[model samples]
Target chain A: MEITIAHLYPELLNLYGDKGNIATLKWRMEQRGINVTVKEYALEDEIDFDGTDILFIGGGSEKAVRMAANRLCEIKKKFEAYADNDGVVLAVCEGFHLIGTYYKLNGEKIKCAGIIDIFAEYTPDRLIGDVLLQSSAIGSTVVGFENHCGRVEIGCYKPLGKVLYGYGNTDSAQYEGVVHQNIVGTHLHGPLLPKNPKLADYIISRALKKKYGSVTLSEIDDTLELQAHKYMADRYKNCVRKKNDDDI
Target chain B: MTKIRNSLAIVACKLLILAGRLMGKKGSSAPGSIAMKISPGVLRSLASQIKGDIIAVCGTNGKTTTNNMIDSLFSSAGKTVICNNYGANMLPGVACAFISRASITGKLNADCAALECDEASLRHIVKHVTPTKIVVTNLFRDQMDRYGEIESTAALLNEAFEKVPEAMLILNADDPLCAQFGKGRNAVYYGVSEDTGLHGEEAKDGRFCPKCGGELEYEYHHYSQLGKYKCIGCGFERPNPNYSATRVDISDGLKFVLSYKGSQHKLELNYRGFYNIYNIIASFAVYETAGGTIEEAKKVFDDYKPQLGRMETYKVGGKNVILNLAKNPAGFNQAIETVCADKKAKDILIVINDKPSDSTDISWMWDVEFEKLKSANLGRLVVSGLRKYDLGLRFKLCGFEGVVIEDISREALEGIISGNGEVCYILANYTALFETQKILKTMEDK
Candidate 1:
């Protein structure tokens, strides 16, 4: 099977090691004997989202997000159509904030692609730490790091996971990330894939299903991958539990 | 009353130092913290007594090495230099450094004070010691928890710059964000003029022009965001560097020709990597601009070795173990490139600690270009530290094949030392570097 992955605004939205997602996705796909061709779409680069089977957008600084939003607006319709067609999409951190309807920063509303039906606003204090989430989509714990000031409001979209530890969508919200169709947007940025290979495989499998109609991905040895995942998940979980115990 | 207060502060600092020594502790910060508590204005008072210029080096990376280089350059010219060589760059630690060198009457007996100031603490330090010259190495995304973004960090430095308008600014012309600091100011810009063959296709930080908000077109990149760049839309280009490394050859050791005012001087550096080349040139620029001769600066570079945990080499078990500090993405990428540049097979030990000094957030590891290691002949990949698995997973995902050891201890060091590879490269974060160095020292003694 073949898949074309288009990395959107890689230069502008490149922060917090978000490019690791691209590395993880490519490695996992190549390991599965799937042919994968990756293309990069930066500030002025022409993007053909229709031909893209999977799309990845990483995080960046606030100013970078502003710059990326201007360029991303040029291809908003194409990206929305790609998502509507069940194209696998993963947007992380500031990328997640930019995919929403609008991000409110310093009392000014910065309009984005509006690809995901959500609104994110900047908080005075940033939420920064390791995050552990019980993701229902992948049916496993997702471990990653969250560093942002945007508090997202998932209006109608399904959440990717429940916040097992750390601040997720917002300080008050119990969930983390937005999942609409095959699209996923999250603030988790341990590049969001290497530690959680299940989600990487799940996204690849979903993209393959969209192309091949009905197919089950062959499972490879996930021993080392799962061990890494479990290590992080347990560490964050114990940290949260310890905090709760101290509070009591 | 002022003498009595200064005397009390000095005594408190000395007592803390003595206690630290008795406890077998490297009390780099405690004495400073205690001195600040004893006399809040001690840093300013002591700094005011200094007879010569105070040179402050502030940036995310290379602050220590650059500060030490400036210190060595000044000292080699027969000037007595006082510096906080223990990597304590904060305000209190800086205060403690001055207090340690000051007499009981709060008199500083030093020809020059060359100090490294943390980017976040630059504002606080400037309030006390008004440096005659300030060198901003480069601004990269670092310690997101402490500094929200690179722009915010730059804003903080700009705010501090406004306070010290008289201080001469030394900047990196190649860095877009750093180059912006030179705008509307008389700044000495230093950058690599010739391409060093370090450019990569990866997404780089500071790719947009700060002036026009347009995408920057790079003539060629020398690693992340350090490149000759121009904006076609606004016609904003790299400023003409007053002090430039006209040519850099990092084939063996760093060999570069420094150009200033129609005169070029050849300099051979004992340091490795292009980043160190930038550091060396930045220090040379500061020295020359501060009335030092090029001949004196060249002599300093001839014998200049970086401080501990920064490319410090040790021989253990008949293998050369090189320790280099990789605190952030930019620094880590340079260290990785330096290792990969060698064709010989080497056992690599990557240690990552999430200590407060080492940045509690470990997400920056994902930003480093570990995939470059795949092309190198890596023998055994030993990953150690509190976040050893994270580093191991990153290497594994990057398609590097080797025996992965996740434990970081003396035993792990022994295993790496006894490995088949003749050379062992140990890349460590801020805290891990110190720990690894102490372990290596212990093993070397045995």
Candidate 2:
């Protein structure tokens, strides 16, 4: 099977090694004896979302998000059509925020693609450091880092996971990220894939199934990858548990 | 009254240092912290007592190495130099450095003070030091949690520049972000004119012109965002550098011709990589503009050993173990390029940490072009640190199939050294560098 990955705004929205997700996804598919081709869509390049199998978008600075939002607005219809057709999409960090209805920063509303039913606003303080989430969608504990001032509010969608550590969508919300069908948006970027090999495979299997029907992926040895994931998950879990104990 | 405060601060700092020594602590920042607490204006008072000019080097990277280079070059020219060579660049650490150099009477007995100032702390430090010359190395996105963004970090330096209007700015002409600082100032620009042709597939930061917000068109990229660029919309281009590296031959160990004041001097640097070339040129620019000869700078370059962990080398089990600091994408990419350029089969160890000192966000590792290393003759790939598995997964994703280890300790180093590769290149982040160095030191002692 052939997997066509469209890396959206790779130049502008590329921050904090978000490109690693693309590398992980491509490598995972290639390991399964599947042919993979990556197409980069920047500010100047025209994108045909219909031709893409899996669409990946990474995080970026505020300025880069603004620049990318301006370009993404032009192709809003194409993106909506791609999503409506059940195209696999994974957006992270600021890219995750841009997929929502709109993101409000510094009292100014920046209109996004409005593909996902979510609204995000800049919080008074940025939520940073390691994050651990018991993701229900992937049926595993997700480990990554969250560094953003925007607090997301999900509407008409389920969260990708429940926050085990670190702030999730909001300070009070127990959930993290937004998931609808094959589309997933999260603020987890340890580039969001390397340590979480199961999630990487989940996204790949979903993409493959969407194109070629129900398929069971052969298990690749995830011994080292799972060890890395458990290490981070346990560290954050213990850290938060200690903080709570001290609070009491 | 101010003299008495200065003396009291000096005595307190000396006592703190003595106490730290007795306690077996390398109280590198404590003395400065205590001295600043004893006297709020101690740094200013001590700096004012210096009989010579004060030069401050500030940037995201290369501040320590470049500051040390300026210190060594000035000292080689028969000038008494006082510097913070202990890799403490913040306000308190800088204050500690100044306090240690001052006499018991709080009088500075140095010909010049070459201090490395942190980018965020530059505004605070420049207000007191009032340096005669300020050199800014190329700015890249680093420690985003502390600095917010690259623009915010640049704003900090810009505010500092306003406080010290008399200071001559030594700017990097090739870096568009650094080039922005030279506007409406007495600036001497230094950059590479010849291309080294080491462009990577990684995304470039600061791609837009600060003046018109127009997308920059690069003639050729030497590395991440450091290249010959022009803005077609506003006609903004690289400034005519007063001190320019006219020719670069990085085939061996960085041989470049530096042109200044209608004279070109060909000097070969002992350091490797394009970033170090910029560091060497920036140091040379500061030294030359400060009334030092090219001949004297050449003597300093010939014997210039990179400060520990910037790109320090050690021999272990008769194998070359090269250690370089890879804190951010730009630095890591340069290190990977340097390693790939060598044809010999090598064992590579990448140590990544998420300590507060190392920038808790390990997301920048994704930005590094690790896929390029897949083609190299890498015998073994070892990944270790607080985020060893993250790096191991990154390498695995890059299609590097080798014995990947996660143990980041002396045992890990020993295992890698025991491998068949004749050379071992260990690239580590900020905190991991010290740990790896300590482990290497213990192994050497054995």
Candidate 3:
């Protein structure tokens, strides 16, 4: 009857309206007559994995990322075990980089949670634009914005989807995100959920099924959501958008 | 060769401006880029010829308004001033403004130049012209894909200011990201020392101390990261501003008491929105700093009509249509506050364009505290522009029902204006501003 969501580093790792994901999840669940409890964990606070349904970690500044990553390094095993069970974790942009092994900063490696087989390094050529991703995990096209200077390396792991347009995980990888067990990671941050209701529902259903086994979430009116997603996705069909200096 | 290139660039730029004017284009940037392509050192050479001071206004919000205010204050004093007007605040626009004011012989005779400098382009711009006074309005997270992050913008600003060490910085002391630049530098600060209690939950990009990365503590916030704040770890705090505004009031227009040089001056303006208070006070600070008296600044500000889209008013179909440009969350949140302050029944039409100038990523739309708008005093809520559906979806998520999506902006305007004699407030992003303004103007007073 009730779902508890944990937002890790809500204040520090807040960027690009990534907190909208939690808001979207909360609003959707509350509309279904289900009670929702949101647990927020700041820098020095302890995280409770037991009975927590969904976990969200957003992007932050380089310093915040370094500081948060170092703080969470000690308890990374708890995160791995949490995911190994049916607990859902959603990480975006710098959060996606946080679950990785290490973040290379100017030839110096800063250790992260190291729960996933992913690594990221700083790049001068920043990948930034409105991106469209065809995600098989949610069985729909995901549309959002990707702005990052870190080119990720997903070593020997299946990606969430192939990049339909814009830069993805790596230029050669042509992939967008990492999907392992109940963990979902992506850099598409239009906050990555309000526009793509199916994916938001997907993350919710997984959490619900884990708690109240084989539960089906009722359908809400998503015409506006799908309209927003398809509008941005269809714009990228024949065109690859890049930021041009002269365009400004 | 330098003289010849200057002559060619100047004449060609003038010819292009004339042609653009003939074609009904309010051209500002394109001709400047063409001139820069011809003469690379044009901005520096022209800027050096200014008889008075070259003041550059840089920040996320209030750049255009502050720069324009400075322009009006100096020009009203009968000084030959050259400014990049109409929100053209990049390197090329600065070049074009100088070229527009240049003589046919490729020499300038301006007494002063008020240039609005874009934050990301400041480093490259400083390579050309060193401003005599640099006014940083405030820092905010704008165009995430373009600026990358707020910290990167602070770094870019630092790199530029380092190049022009002699240029005195007029900073917003209340902003932790901005005031950090004044440390150990020949700079003065200006801010609203009194808490106006007007606050929004927009992205506070300056939450951490720029000095030591320690989390900052706030006594109260006037708005997004701007107010009385101090770092917990480092002793760095909001410096007592050399010029500050206190006793703020925005109930009807703006009224505040300005404090500077150990004297208190009462200041009032016919402007809405709490954010414009910063623009007015910052302009007054710059005006006084550049050797102008307070009386002249106040005289000009009292009679000042805001530049297009800064609460511009039009009457169509017997409805007052107010058009303002709200690009980012902080700006949008303030605009929403203005609308919510009005007790009169009003219909709100939001046009969100995803043009590259608007930074194709419209994700920031969700960041605007749209829920603050009281549904009680609201009429039909319509969404338009290229990214209308996206904003509409954001509304849908907020549990708003009966949302209208009219792609054609003109009809949206007409639709809102025709309804039940409600005051219509048309808000648009970058590219949609001009179009909405033009359509509103055509539909006005027929």
Positional deviation of residue B418's Cα in model 1 after best superposition, in angstroms: 2.2
Tens digit of per-residue lDDT, candidate 1, span A89-150: 99999989888879899999999888877989998687877789998888989998888889
Task: Give the per-residue lDDT digits (tens) of candidate 3, residues B176-242.
Answer: 9899999899888998887677777677667888889898888878777888999999989999998
**Cα lDDT of model 2 by residue, A55-170, tens digit:** 99888877788888887787888888888889999999998998887889888989888787788999757677678999889999999888788899996689989998887788
| Least accurate 10 contiguous residues by lDDT in model 3 chain B | B407-416
> Tens digit of lDDT per residue, candidate 2, span B1-446?
87788789899998888898899866578788778887888888888877777999988778898999999998888888879888778787788888877887878878889999888888878766879999999888787756666777888889999998999999989889999888899899988887666777564778877666678899877777778899988988888788888678766888888888999888877777878878888998998887888898888888988888876788888778889998988888888988888778888899988887788888888778888888668888888888877787777776667757677877789989888887889999998998899889877633
Candidate 2 CAPRI assessment class: acceptable
**Chain A accuracy as TM-score for every candidate:** 0.94, 0.95, 0.95
Fraction of native contacts under 8 Å reproduced by each candidate: 0.66, 0.73, 0.64
Candidate ordering by DockQ (highest first): 3, 2, 1
Looking at model 3, the pairs that clash are none
Evaluation by lDDT, superior candidate among 1 and 3: 3
Please tell me the TM-score of chain A for candidate 1.
0.94
Off by over 4 Å in 2: A241-248, B23-27
In model 1, the clashing pairs are none
Model 1 global lDDT (CA atoms, 0 to 1): 0.83
Error of 1 at B332 (Å): 2.5
Give the best candidate by lDDT: 3
Q: How far out, in Å, is residue B139 in model 1? A: 1.7
